[model samples]
Target: MAEVFIGSEEVAAGRVTRHELRRWYAPVYRGVYARKDIELSLRDRAIAAWLASGRKGVVAGVAASGLHGAPWVDPDVPIELVGVRIRPQHGLVPRADRIASDEITRVGGLPVTSRVRTAFDMGRHLERTDALVRLDALMWNQKFNRADVRALGDRYPRAAGLRRLLELLPLVDGGADSPRESRIRLWLLDAGLPQPETQIPVLATSTRPVAWLDMGWRDYKVAVEYDGDHHRKDRKQYVKDIARLRMLEALGWIVIRVIAEDKPSDVIARVEEALIRRGCSVEVDDLHRFARTFAA
Candidate 1:
């Protein structure tokens, strides 16, 4: 009763009187209602959008990614649907795009775009950084074939962001654990640094891995890690991190730790210096050019 529902269906089913519905429910979209006091999650909004579309549209884009258990999705992002043309609303974006039968799947009883289709739509719709961030999260949560996404691109060559999608496809790495990590990775690449490997394992034994480096060049034994507030705020993690840093240093690994307050340029500079110290040649002028243009 508290969940999102079609207003007419609930009233006609005799579950609630019209008066009660008017008193206790709030409109989420035309004809879609949820309890007035309930705060809508992304899933709730997706469901509302679907109900508003009379169950004809498949939820797609970031909302579909979220429903597929991908982390880091902004709950406030508009719910997107394909195959229906419901009027634009605050929380719902309806697309009249055609969807293949195989491209749709059910998530929690609601139709949603399949993982690859969701990835394809995201790459074709979102801006570059945001698309990569969500794609990284989605891929990290659920492994999908990059070829499948590319195939969809081949099918929809005339799609709006196809060029951008092609440009971004090579850059996605599921090993990125957070949006910040993805951002830093992009910045390093944009700055003309060699593409660093991700999730490099520090082996304690042939079969046993002691720890994983967030990202870096293994040949140089240099790594860069982004430390969110949790790394510092959690006392146990803080203590373990200090010990871990010592161990890595002993193993001749230079780890450049990044925190929230560090400027992107400064972090990149530190990484460049570390790489240089480790005998990895980099163009100084190129790094400076990137520093001058680095945004976010």
Candidate 2:
């Protein structure tokens, strides 16, 4: 089969011989196999992990996020599962967390954590920055009520990382287009600046929206934009961005453009200066502390 399957089961069912499996399929786990010619995606790997668990585990965390159609998931990330007690392998992580029946749902006939449950698990289990990034991506794909996840936390009052999860809930915004944008937003918030709105729309003469700012204060007309390499690499996008920036400036918008090489402190300073120039006051001492922590 082109898809991931249990090699021994296929052999037992007379679907394929042991020699055929060995020649045409590559082992993904202890007994899981996929066609050698096919490229395995994150879902395939997740399914393989489930098969490795003998179909007993429910996929969770980033794996579940990916299965729910969230973008930007690293295909190589280890698949996380709940409700299984299998020994750890190269690409599978088995967790013993308490998962409720409502928290699990079937995607493509595979049991995966529901969107809210996946977000909850991710926020509690992953590092803060990574958790926010994944949460933004997941929320961007699937609209879920934060209160639902909070209720889950209330149910598991003493769950590990519950406090951290509560703290992170307020920062979760689905409008972020990229992880870098989310990071920049976090930096501004940590610097004691106002929480800038994401994907702020600037309208043209007509009712149609002309451009969307990455993150900005609408009242102050100040925006922070993270420019990835693709903006410069793609000639068409570069030309379009130049035109877009000019239009935004004409509309009295102060855009702070950030690139990969820019230091975090410099980016924050630029944004802070722009906001201040646009009549938004920020605490300089608090910002300096944040900058130092970011630099460290």
Candidate 3:
């Protein structure tokens, strides 16, 4: 039987030979050589290398997302790494910031760029959306609030996503169960639609004083919703969705439905049209790419 994890003995004894290693199927990271069933993209390789190198690194930026269980972040994504104090001889240092005694820690047994120390290490170094997504996911899913992210950022003012996160973090709601909510919110924002409070109380005289709607517009009595495929396939959910829509209508709320393809633009147009008919005369303009910087 063979062991899954490799150690220094294998490296020294030549037990890790090219001929023997090639027979295995998992994707191998070059140089530092970590393997898992999933393919390691460039960013993955870099961070993995840094991690395997004897407690010398902590992965940050979009690349650290895999550890946090974010859906999918590009593996080659360039982020920052900070390690134990050493000389310039260890060239794996990407964005090297020499840390004083107070700034760094070994979180969960791995040498990590401290949550506060990350800004000085990697915050200002990523793309706008990538940076924002990481911040949002960390706060919402990881349960960090803007203040925690900031106090950490305050220690390292030049971090990658700090200022942008401070501005946008208020918008990240931990309650969203899927990416659909994010896409819908972003589309509506771009279209100049009034920001609808999500999971809001839809109130009217009824058996129940108030009920939650996925997305709601107050003045216009209109609601926008995303029906994930599970709702269609699950018989109980299908029935419940129909009943909910009918209930909202009876309760004086108009519901507009949205799906995946409705993304990028059509979602914006449909929402705008529905809102216009509701008596808000906001101009409907074409949704065009501004700079086309990053892929959603």
Candidate 4:
């Protein structure tokens, strides 16, 4: 309930004092500040905590993921929030969403805007790749469900960035930590190919789960994995890689290994070739249209 001061004309009905402002509040960035904390919060966390300090912290990106009940951030990722000053030491990410704070309202009792608004905010601040990663991870890994995010579109009818993020959501591949996977996924989407599944679990009646795949079409028995060259240079790891590939091949699984140079076109062609080889007639045309016609 305590409030950190922004600025005011009267500390005591007279001229402002620089000494007093520094004494009363620790400055954070231009107009922001921590009430009395000595350390400076990161650009992002300071802004988030500042807003969350009763000013309505509009959660987006990883912060929104946490609020939605699934926090999908790298271990090293700081705890980014908007609004408020008080925070734990060394690992918080706060940033200012300097839009009209008045229009923002709490969603799901968390200080975030409605899902649509949150998504909109995310598109603005986060890089497109970062946005896609969180979107894919949240929808697939966290199972937060896209319907919840979509449902808010009506409420935030004019939300700024929703349209773009929605367009790119399906293009986001699951289980991607690196930028290469991100690029591959986007390329597939652009080529109008079915987005490949990320980290799909494979289980058989006769055995326990032997492997979880990076990208695959389980129904078609087609698996596509990006094999960056870094894994094989050492003789020790190279031998192990060959054994794994041979075992997977013996299991009637089609494995396509590829690398960075194939960017854009190769991923699309490879997935298409695999599906066709497996007797699945689905063209790249009908891939992402799965949810378009059906209304849930």
Q: What stretches of model 2 exceed 4 Å from their correct place?
A: 284-291
lDDT of candidate 3 vs native? 0.56
On a 0 to 1 TM-score scale, where does candidate 1 land against the true structure?
0.93
TM-score of each: 0.93, 0.94, 0.65, 0.60
Candidate 4: 10-residue stretch with minimal lDDT: 287-296
**For model 4, how does the per-residue alpha-carbon lDDT over 164-278 read when each residue is reduced to its tens digit?**
7666654654476455666566655555555677776666556677677777777777776676677656787778777777777777788777676664455566777788888
Ranking by lDDT: 2, 1, 4, 3
How many pairs collide in each candidate, listed in order?
0, 0, 8, 18
Deviation in Å, model 1, residue 13 alpha carbon: 3.0
RMSD of every prediction: 2.1, 1.8, 6.1, 8.5
Over the stretch 1-296, how does candidate 2's per-residue lDDT look in tens digits? 54999998899999999999989899999999999998889989999999999889999999999999999998878999999899998989999898999999999888999999999999999998889999999989978899999999989998899898889999999999999888888777777788989999898698888899998999999988888999999999999989999999999898899998887777777887888888887875765685658652
How would you encode candidate 1's per-residue C-alpha lDDT over 1-296 as one tens digit per residue? 74899989989999998999899888989998989987889888898898889888899999999999999887778999998877888888887677899999998788999999999999888988899998999989988888999999888888888889888888989999889999899888778788999999997647777889899999999999888999999999999999999999998999999998988788888998999999999864765575548544
Candidate lDDT (C-alpha), each: 0.89, 0.89, 0.56, 0.56
- Model 3 clashes, total count: 8
Q: In lDDT terms, how accurate is model 1? A: 0.89
Question: How far off is residue 84 in model 4, in Å?
Answer: 12
